[model samples]
Target: MTARPAKAVSRRPPRPARRTSAVRPPRAGRGGPRRLYSRVRRAWDRPLTAYYLILGGSLLITVLGLVMVYSASQIKALQSGLAPSYFFRKQLLAAAIGGVLLLAASRMTAKLHRAMAYPLLAVSVFLMCLVQIPGIGVAVNGNRNWLSLGGPFQMQPSEFGKLALVLWGADLLARKQERKLLTQWKHLLVPLVPVAFLLLGLIMLGGDMGTAIILTAVLFGLLWLAGAPTRLFTGVLGGAVAIGALLILTSANRMSRLACIGATDPGPGDQCWQAVHGIYALASGGFFGSGLGASMEKWGELPEPHTDFIFAITGEELGLAGTLSVLALFAALGYAGIRVAGRTEDPFVRYAAGGVTTWVMAQAMINMGAVLGLLPIAGVPLPLFSYGGSALLPTMFAIGLLIAFARDEPAARAALALATRKPVFGRKPAGVRWKTMRRRVARRPSGER
Candidate 1:
């Protein structure tokens, strides 16, 4: 048999049977779309994904806001005899300052966060009060919530108040939870409600029902997070509804907004003009949009093309696609906030994150609803996307706080360590660990056995 096989064999040795490989994993960061999707999904499972998601989402929206601000305000800026980049420049400055604040906030330790909680609340309250002083308080759009620092430098204390409430409320509830006091309704209601109510009173006095509504959301959100009784929310709900309705009825300006929502007048009234123009801006965009910077609405047809109704300009320029993109971005942000809030082991992180999420999301919904005629137009800017220095600064800072909480997670810690570790390729290993070295020494002596 061997001789027969040798007879058949050629000059070369019989080639080994072609070795078949076992199924190999697709190369990382390679392959078709499906493989790419799978890789991304897997990557998302890593520890720092949440932190990166928050950072990326915040940065994108902020940058988008700056671009839109420039586009939306250019015509108006020029019409006002100012530089075309006036609003853009101002917004850029605010964003720069806000980005710095964000980085600083994300790096703060938990102890520093806790330590600063009361001081933040105090500063917010003091600023809120300062806005009530004779000359310091400046009214805009009928809201006396602005602190006048001089020409072209007014700031909204109310925006900062939103963050202050979250921090202080989180601290308060966390301390109470430690003592098992959260179970008591009184402990739940005290301090937070009183102080929040006082703050709300001051805000309402400024005639800023929009800010008041957002603050109320923060207040209720913290309550719900701390496990307040259903009846408590019910009572609070009824009270809030009543107060909101009363406030709406009492103000001619707010009532007009209410009318704008329900107005059936074929012709737009002065009260309904802004709302009507917003609808026009959005509707005129069709689906894809009128084209960015090509919005007729932004060309003096729509009010607040860069500020409150930027969504309208977006809809007009990018069309429904643009508007929905804005909404989608906001939804993504809300999802991220929920993820951060839910994943935290710390009660303060949960409470504060939840409150901030509620404030931002609730405010967004109202602003969007108003633009859509589903609700009254509240003069709240669209969080990070709106062209307001006050709103932008605090929102970026809150995002930073969320980043800090995300960083505090166990997975994030591990990811950070891996990222910061020195590359292993060229470095000498610290000659075996001390314990291992000792074990080796002992093993050498035991070889006598």
Candidate 2:
């Protein structure tokens, strides 16, 4: 009976062998650096990332600048027998007006921007020409780059020149590109380079080499963005350098500035006084700085503590951490600008964004480099971080331009539309909820009300 039962074995197939050598995919969020990189990539890939970066970075820089201006200018204002908040109030007012301009610029269409380009260029040129006239031009710190707007109000046409160049150059390049004329080096450099050099001449005539340098950077940025050939780009660059060197060599003041680079001593007539003190302020700042408004350099020790050397005062009061934060903000703003330029299909947006980024970044580097004693003192105010209303106004408007371009990105536009469609997160839109409630009420029995 047992043998008979054994002969009746089941016909089920043999169990398949498990493949022990098979590799398993790594789990999500398990690998350390890979996970972090993925997260960063995702965040960077978000539609509104560049927009938020531009908006948040610019706002933070501006707000922090206002705070620093108030802090750094208090001593200077009191020394001049004015209220401590005088400069602060003026800057705040300019910021407010600039906010309105920024809003208007951001809301305008691309066509409107292109339309305004010529008008803005005209106004800027008119003002720049006006700066050459002694009666209307106001000289500050030995540079005749400002226009007296009557009373205490002053405007720097060169500051506006930066914006004008960005807009006009962008529009010019975009149009030429559409016409397929950028292939020839002549068409690329013709009006653009000549006009830029003209602006540089105007800026230099006012003895504002700093502004000239920034404008030069913007010019080159435009040319490069327009895809200028290597030889042409280098030729233009060489000409600029030679011109800059000639100017520096010819002037006593410029020579003095050139000699002050990396100087450790005050030298004769305290020529290096500002530079040395700037180093002192930064070195004394240690890691975290003394505290807000606690800078010793601002108490008559440092020159232009609220403008050219503002970074030094910031170093003294806020320390390395604060300075790094400012640097990071600028870096983020620049990176965002580059991202916007890179992602845009529109040539105007690309050129405009790149030009603006180059302008701001070049200026920041110059100011910071001068403060750090790494370069000659260029007498340029730190963009957004300085106390001058003229500088702040134009820079803020430029920031608005960046925001506008960032908003114009296809992904950014979609994100903005979705955001407007649903203003709140994690909940149905109010309109949708309201409609649903009305439908439910209409479907209910009268007694169920």
Candidate 3:
């Protein structure tokens, strides 16, 4: 065997680069860098643009939410004999925790994200189940979706379930893409849709139709992005509408809510009282608003002014300017999230980004719509702009995931590499001249310049 020796392997030569300009991008002929606006725009159109947009928007919204929460809650707290800052302190603590989660998640690697998906799904399912336990689950208003773990702090399992669903669905779809399973409708819908239904069933079982609707939005978004057939989408949408109608019909509360949708007078009970007062709050503010913490609605004129109806309070206090600013921030978030989904090469990134964007945008729309009397009173919280601790933490974490995806973009990678390189004695460590001059000298053969 040793005497037989080995056969030498041959390798193919590398292909030459194409000479045509079509193989390259069009460059500016001249003066491109001289235009400051164009230069800044080009710089901002890099891989990390989405990252900065998400960060700035999320921070602004969260801070604004804290301020508004305090403003809205102070009166109620004083009446309850608690300190004015009691609710404010709780919300600030939640924000701080969420901030830490955001920073940690932003630094997570892609592999880690994929790895955590399944476990998250399992854990979220278990938590949702636990929320059904008689002693463990505490009923708030009408929804038995919160867990009271022996303290002032309570956990809303459905909120974490939303995050888990995003991760798991993204991971599942990404795997399907790897296996080329996305093209077949059966392969695409199986398991994912069924699992989603299961989760939604559990959430609705807890009487949390609002959260269920948001989760449904996430499911619809993921399916849309996965390229399900038009017919299939229509069928699914129809089924959703039917289910929504049935849910509304079954509950007197929900029925009253629907009736109040376009009502100038919600009549008798406070079934639509919040919505009516919300409109009043906004109307009384006029254009410039009454000023921060100046909301008359917060003085028991409106209900849940710090939570589901914070946007109403915002309109009342901050006026049109403040409301528009809040809308602008949410628009920034939606833009950044969608931008990330559109630009990423990974299926997980695309699915996850789209799912989170849909969740946040849909929830915001529902919350604002309910307050403004456009939709039924859904009781959904505005993302990053509502006063719920459970909602804030997972949402901030999702935003962090979007940031992580942005940072992983190619331009961001290149920028990071360039920034990390140390310059040699006040000169760039790498540049066009440094590379080209040495190359030209080498081509001259005897160190000739």
Candidate 4:
């Protein structure tokens, strides 16, 4: 056995040593520390400064709103034998719901948003119609535009209508532009006439002139973005202004309010009373502010302080500095929105974003102007700072849309991801996956082989 083993033990020369590189295995698909590091790097690369400006501004305004609402509503609520926090609680709830909506809307794609435009517009129209129904529509301070959903949950469909109109109009204009048909008046009239009629008719029925004006502004913005004829747009603008003037003249209260702009000592219970009080609040606030919850006018000295006059209350509480801050926030929103619209190659997004920006910023200006007595009381609430569910929901959603655009911005995605600490790829369907197949050759049956 030993002899045979020795004879057979002609071991082959040792196989050449397999040389291996010293390199470490490719790090497993960015896991743990690597994944975190990559995310941090990506974030560092992408900054969402525009988004932060808008969102931070919104948060600041909302916080100030809570303080002002409580301060402004307390006296009224107490006089009416209700809790001081009544309006504050309602506003806080609305803000909470609005924040959720904003986050959700921010996550939606432009395509999905455009697809939703039709349904949303339809729903808005239906709700606006519902507000005309007796019993369901509650008259608030003589306006029959409010739908009472029972137990302090009243909504004004017209507020939502503003957003819907902007979305719908933007979609319509985008589509027409894509087809190179937007320049034709007939094509423009299709979406334009109905939206205008719907908004104007509903608002006229509800007597919500402020909202109607905002809707018109949104329409005009869309038209401008669609590259409508300058002459035609200018003509429309003139006509609209004339019509608005006529409407204001015909309305006794509106005319009186407008006349009261520079009047001193507007008598109590007069149309000018609120404006006078607002001016007083602003004057008293001066530079720094009267300090939170310390406004003199909010003690039943000012009307609708938590709504139309909330800005005045903010001024009175937080001062000129606060007012400027609020203004700055809105400016930031406008800038971000414009940037998004400009960056988007898609016409729909461009128009939609522009329309929304106009809708919101215009409304803000009107509200602030009204509060400062520079314009008549238009009954428009300060966006994100007013104490109305109707206004809060849509405003937050609009902000969300802006955030979505900002997030998707090509130049700023890295910054935005870093700021949000969220994945930039957005959400995807769960079942999506890739598969590989190995090729197999089949021989003919054994007989053929």
Query: Model 2 clash pairs?
Result: none
Worst 10 residues of 1 by lDDT: 433-442
Q: What is the C-alpha lDDT of each candidate?
A: 0.84, 0.90, 0.88, 0.81
Which of candidates 1 and 4 is the stronger one according to lDDT?
Answer: 1
Lowest-scoring 10 consecutive residues by lDDT in candidate 3? 436-445
Residues 1-449, model 3: lDDT tens digits: 56986888769788998877565555554446557677777876876678788999999999999999999999989988999998899899999999999999999997898899999899889999998988888899989999886667898989999999899999999999899999998888888999999999999998999999999999999999999999998998999999988998999888888889967765886566778998999888878799998999889888898999999889988899989999999998999999999998999999999999999999999998988889988888899888889999999999899889988889878776654555569675433234442231112445444
Per-residue lDDT of model 2, residues 135-236, tens digit only: 889888898988888888988989999999999999999999999999998899989988888888888889999899999999999988998989999988
What's model 3's lDDT at 204?
A: 95
- Segments in model 2 whose C-alpha atoms lie over 4 Å from true places: 1-31, 423-449
- The global Cα lDDT (0 to 1) of model 3 is 0.88
State TM-scores per candidate.
Answer: 0.85, 0.89, 0.86, 0.81
Candidate 3 RMSD to the real structure: 16.4
What TM-score does model 4 achieve against the real structure?
0.81
lDDT of 3 at 163: 92
Residue 284 accuracy (lDDT) in model 1: 86
In model 3, pairs of residues that clash are none
> On residues 1-449, what C-alpha lDDT tens digit does candidate 1 reach at each position?
45544456467878899999889887765668878898888986777777887888789888888888998999989889999999999999999999999999999976687888889888888998998898889988767888877788889888988988988999999999989999888999998899999889989888888889999999999999999999987898899899889988888877777778855442544668888888887778899987779989887877888999988888888888877878877887788788889988889889988988898899889888877778888888888988999999999999988889889998889768645544269542343222332232112434541
